[model samples]
Target: MIDLKTQYAGLQLKSPIIVGSSGLTRNPSKSKELEEAGAGAIVLKSLFEEQIEIQANQISDPNDYNPEAEEYLRLYMKQNHLQDYLDLIKRTKEVCTVPVIASINCYKSDAWTEFAAEMEKAGADALELNLFFLSTDLTHNGPLIRDLYIDVIKRVRQTIKIPFTVKMGRNVGNVTALAYQLQANGADGFVLFNRYFQPDINLKTIELIPGSIFSRPEELYDTLRWIAILSGKIPHVSIAGSTGVHNWEGVAKCLIMGASAVEMCSAIYQKGAGVITESLEGLSKWMEEQNFHNIAQFKGMLDASKLPNPTIYERHQFMKYYSNR
Candidate 1:
């Protein structure tokens, strides 16, 4: 049998295809189906900071804020939402054999950090912190923003013992510096590029609307490049690719380029859970053709530094190649 086994953030996953945090993952039934369909792990939908704050705000008004009423109402809503999440984790753990990863989209070090401990208590095998700020403040610099990310990971790390992964955005000016800082402070894994929400203008209605949530196949190259670059640099941190991995070929490319695992959402949304099974099984067959028995045999094989000419990964537009062709 071909060994598809891989490790992500200290947890052993049977495959490399992790279902990234999304609404679909919140359902224990869907989670179990993904597992049965050959998924490596499942990341439950993230509990956003905004999600908690909005619920709290709707129930209690700050202008007429009553300490007793606010406390009661806030706790009531938070508990209800949090209870559903925790229950999902517990129920999913019971139903599925694969690792159940809890997710949180936190922009700061605040009350939500406390929830990490509760997540651990609820039987989450790992925690993925999708940490990023809007950065609307003009005063922010690389170091300050980097420090905030480091602090967020550090605070949460203190709250729970389960291995944690930081899902970062592409805009972080110095990914190397940010990853190093988080690794130093106790991040066990880093998922390159969390897909953020984008806005679009409605030409007909003159209103701002949400952009396409699904990732295009072309977006895979940029993510693959970073994974290849960072894998060679930081071998200690378990690296997973996110946003743009859509098929088995994409999965194979990521693994060969140095990712231990890959997270997929848009593909799942469009293709259904069968994509996980097909991707994993197809990868195994391809590995067989390549005469490799395990993921370790080919993982990182295509790291830029491993290639004879490292410039292939760094070079962008080639007027030379275009002119020649």
Candidate 2:
């Protein structure tokens, strides 16, 4: 039998198929379904810091006539039900047998540390901080943003002893430096590249339209490249590949590139929870065909340091191709 058991952020997972934070995980029934379907772990729907701050503002505002109140309410509606999230973890623990990870998106470092502690008390097997900052201010630089992340990690680490991972974006100047720093600061693992939802232009009305298109198969290429480059570079840091992982082949590719596990949001949104079983089956079939007994043998097989051409991952081929040709 193929051993699907693997380690994610020090948590022993039965499989590497993690149901990423999304609306599906927001529902208790759906979360239970995913657990029953053999998901390694479930990241509860993320509680957005922006949403919390907006709610706090609305609740404290004296004027009821503010037009933005409506927008605030709409944003508030998208927030995860913390009580429900906790109950799901408790109940899933009782019936289902897998790790239930709680996810939180924090804007301020100190403000959300208490909440992280609360999640630990709520019986979350681990916590995944969906740390994000849109550093648009000219006054703030990369070091400042990195410092914010460090502060947040430090605060959360102090409050909660549960093993925690961080889901980060690729906007940083030096990913390797940041990854190593986070590892040193007590982060158990890193989920590479949280795809931000960018607003699009509506030419007809000249309005900014909001929509996050589900990731396509091709989007996995970029994530694969980074995972391959940074896999074994960071000390005691596990890597999870997120975004554009729509199928089992993508999961296999991530493992080969040194990702400890794979997280999926768009695929479940498109294919439903049943996709979990399909993905695992596909992975098991591939392993059998390849004559591999376990995930360890194949994981990180194509990482940059192990590859014949390590520099290929570092240099951009687009400019090189045009200039040389």
Candidate 3:
């Protein structure tokens, strides 16, 4: 008998396969379909702060552009978007048997975070803050920018009673230190390395274009290295793998690196939701072959802290391999 059960951010997941937040999980029907297809949890489509702000900015009076009017418009837009998301949470919760995690994409600790409490009231099992800030300002220093992320988590923690996880970006001065600080500030869990939209240069047009929107399989290693370094280092904080998880093999790799669960979207987009069923079956067969009856038996077996030489994760250059070659 094989048991794939796992725990993430205090929620019991029958499997470690969570349908990540995207257009794939924007509707309740999609949520139900994924659950039926054997998904462990659903991270509902994120409520973007820019979505509200843009709508507010678009409204400018012909002759009189009032700051107060824009402020009121921003508030109204915020509430409208929040209500729609709350409705999604309530409806998805009603249809899906698995945990429903609400997501918010924000760059600052603004009033928008207060809506986290409202989402919990609407039946969201937990919250995942898709936190990212592209620091383009010349004056912005590393520590000052890091503080913004910390402040956002702290504010959200104060508002929501349910467990919340921070889905952070990989570009940081010291990821280990930031993870420790966020954990100290009350992050229940973390989804390693949020995938950002890459930009590509259009040679013919001499313009910038959006690169591939979906994560590729090769992107898994960046997240894997961090998971191996951070897992088991913190107390009571779960680590979730995100980005580049395309199949059961990818899923198993993350588990071995000490991830409690993995968030997948790009795979489902390319292969359909049936990939979930296939991955689960493949994982079970692999586990049986390895003589592992449960997830805990093999999970985190290769994390940096568990290995004899922890420096393996810290090594950046391929000098050793080049020398041997």
Candidate 4:
């Protein structure tokens, strides 16, 4: 039998297909089904920072300039929302054999992070911090924004014993440097890219509208390029390819490029849970064809550092190809 096991942030997963945090993983019943369908691990739907703050504001008087009441309401709202999340973790753990990872969608470091300890206590096998911040401010520079990310990782690291992975957006000036800093600040691993809410124009209406929320298979190339570049560069840190991994071909490519795992959200949304099983079967058949017995045998085989000519990953503009065409 081909060994399909892989590790992500020190968690030994049965397969490389981790269901990314989304509505599919919001309930215990759904988590159990995904596990049965052969998901290596499950990332619970992220508890958004906006959800807590918005609820708190509703309960408290914004006109009243009372710090004490504000603080109390913030704590109350956090706890109320957190209790549901903690319950989800606890109940899911009871029903499923795979690892249950708690997720937090945060923009800044604050008291809400202190609740990471509570998540661990409630039996979360690990934590996935979806750190998001896009600064359009004129005063903000890349370094300052990078520092803020480091601070958030540091705060959570101080509070939790379980291993945590940072899910980062691709908007930063320096991807490798930011990854290095986050790893130094106690990040166990990283998810290469997080999809943000995109806006589109309604040509007929002449107004802004929400863009397609789902990621297409073609979007996998960017994540693939970065994974191949960074996977070989970062030592002892696991990298998970995310956003646009839609099938077994994507999974095999990610593994070849040295990714420990690949997270899928849109794929699962478009296809049903059976997609997980289908991909795993496809991977096993492909491995047999390639004469590989285990994942590590071919993992990172195509990474930039391993190539004779490493500049292929750095080439941009594709002027030569365009000219020939």
Candidate 5:
């Protein structure tokens, strides 16, 4: 039998197929189904920082707050919601057999550390920090923003003993440097990129429209390129490809390009949890055909370093090819 087991961030997963943070994992029954269908790990739907703050704001009466007291009250509410998230981790761990990774997003370094500790105490197998900051302010330079990430990682690392990974957006100007800093700061692994929900223009209504609920198949290429580029560059850090991985072909490609694992969200949303079984089976069959018995044997085989022309990964070759035709 082909071995589907793979290592991710020092944790041995039953398979390389992880159910990325989504609503599916939030439901105990759906999470159970995903595990039954051969998922290696499950990332619970992320608890948003904004959501917690919103809840806190609603609970606090404006009349009850002097400016100083209001600030204190907000901080208290944020901490309280984080405790609630810890409760989620405990509850999910009690029912799930596979690794339960708690996810958190926050702007403050202190919040990240405190919540990470709470998650560890709640028995989370690992933590995935979806670190996000909109780089819209002119006063903040890349180095400053990068420092925030380092600080966040450093503070959180001190609090939690469990393995932790970071999910980052692609907006950083110096991605390579940031990735290196994050790894140096003690991130066990890094998910290549996180897709942001971009609002669309509804010309007819003259209103901003919500982004697509699902990722398109074409979105996989961006992740593929980065994984291939960063794989050889950051060999020690486990890279997991995410966004638009919808089928076995995409999963196999990610592993070949040096990804330790591939995360699936949109695909699982499009197809049911059973898609995990199909993906694993397809990967196994492909591996057998390729004469490879395990994931590591062929992982990163197609990385840029291994390519005859490394520049192909960096340049837009499609335009050249089509123009020549």
Candidate 6:
């Protein structure tokens, strides 16, 4: 019997197949079923910081809206989300033995950050900060934007006792440096690449529409490369791959590349909970074939940082391929 047990975000997981935060994870009954289906952990659907802010424009005129009423409504929204989220955490913890990781979509380091403490108190094993801004601000330089993420982590790290992770966007530059800085700032783990909603235009109506939310299996290469690069470098920081993982091979490949774990949501949305079982079973069979008994045995076997030819990852000019061709 092979042991798939691995630690992620400072939490011990029975397997690496964590159900990433999405609409599918919001249901309590479904969460229990996912655990039974071999999920190591489940991240609750994210509560957005923007969700609590008052939509002041809803009122046609400034004079028509009562200032006190607007403030009350904003407070109510925040509290409502918190109350329901806390209840979900409590109920999930009761029904499932696996870790229940609470996720929050935060773009700033202010009042919204205070909820981290409450989530910890409410029995959340760990918190996953889905830190990203769908749009960019031209006024801010790269350093300023980067510092925002660090500041958010520092604020929440001071507030919560439970372990926490920062889920980064794909466009983050100099990832090695960012990972090092975030680890120093108090991030227990780093999830590579949070999938964002892709916007598209409808040619006929010229209206905006959403592109595919699901990640393709081929997209795994981007995450695989980073995990291979960062795993050995930041030994203290746990790495979990979020996008492009859709099968048992992807899970095994992630572990082999030095990821502490891999998260799956698109697969669940496409194939339902049985995908978890298929992933776990295939991983165990692969492990047995490779003469390994546990996850750690083969972990980091292909890390670029550990290799003599580490420059292979950085050489993206394709000169060698062209010459060979």
Candidate with best lDDT: 4
Query: Per-residue lDDT tens digits of candidate 1, residues 82-115?
Result: 8888998999999999999999998878777888
Model 2, position 318: C-alpha lDDT score: 57
lDDT of 6 by residue, 1-325 (tens): 7899998988999999999999878988999999999999999999777766643234446566598876666667678768898999999898999999999998777876678888999999999998875446678677877788788888988888899998888877778888899899899998887988889889999999999889899989889988888886776668998799999999988888889999999999999999999999999999999999999898888887678877666685256667678
Q: Which 10 consecutive positions of candidate 6 have the poorest summed lDDT?
A: 53-62
Ten consecutive residues with minimal summed lDDT in candidate 5?
106-115
Instruction: List candidate 5 segments past 4 Å from native.
Output: 64-80, 316-319, 322-325
Order of models, best lDDT first: 4, 3, 1, 6, 5, 2
Q: Which model, 3 or 5, shows the larger lDDT?
A: 3
lDDT of each: 0.88, 0.83, 0.88, 0.90, 0.86, 0.87
Measured with C-alpha atoms, the lDDT of residue 312 in candidate 1 is 67
> Candidate 6: lDDT of 189?
94
Q: After superposition, how far is residue 42 of candidate 5 from its true place, in Å?
A: 0.5
**In model 6, which regions exceed 4 Å deviation?**
54-66, 204-207
Model 2 is weakest, by summed lDDT over 10 consecutive residues, at 74-83
Task: Specify the poorest-scoring 10-residue window by lDDT in model 3.
Answer: 315-324
Which residues of candidate 1, in runs, are more than 4 Å off? 60-65, 315-325
lDDT per residue, candidate 4, 1-325, as tens digits?
A: 8999998998999999999999999889998999999999999999888988788778746557588877887778878988988999999999999989999998878855677899999999999999878889999998899989989989898889899999988897788889989999999999988999989999999999999999999999999988988886777769999989999999999989989999999989999899999999999999999999999999999998898866677764365557678
Task: Give the residue spans of candidate 3 off by over 4 A.
Answer: 60-73
Residue-pair clashes per prediction, in order, are 0, 0, 0, 0, 1, 0
Distance from true location, Cα of 39 in model 1, Å: 0.2
**Least accurate stretch of 10 residues (summed lDDT) in model 4?**
315-324
Q: Per-residue lDDT for 170-194 in model 2, tens only?
A: 8866788888888888889989878
For model 6, state the Cα shift of residue 248 in Å.
0.6
lDDT of 5 at 152: 90
Query: Per-residue alpha-carbon lDDT of model 3 for 52-119, expressed as tens digits?
Result: 77766666662464777667776787788789989999999999999999999987688656789899
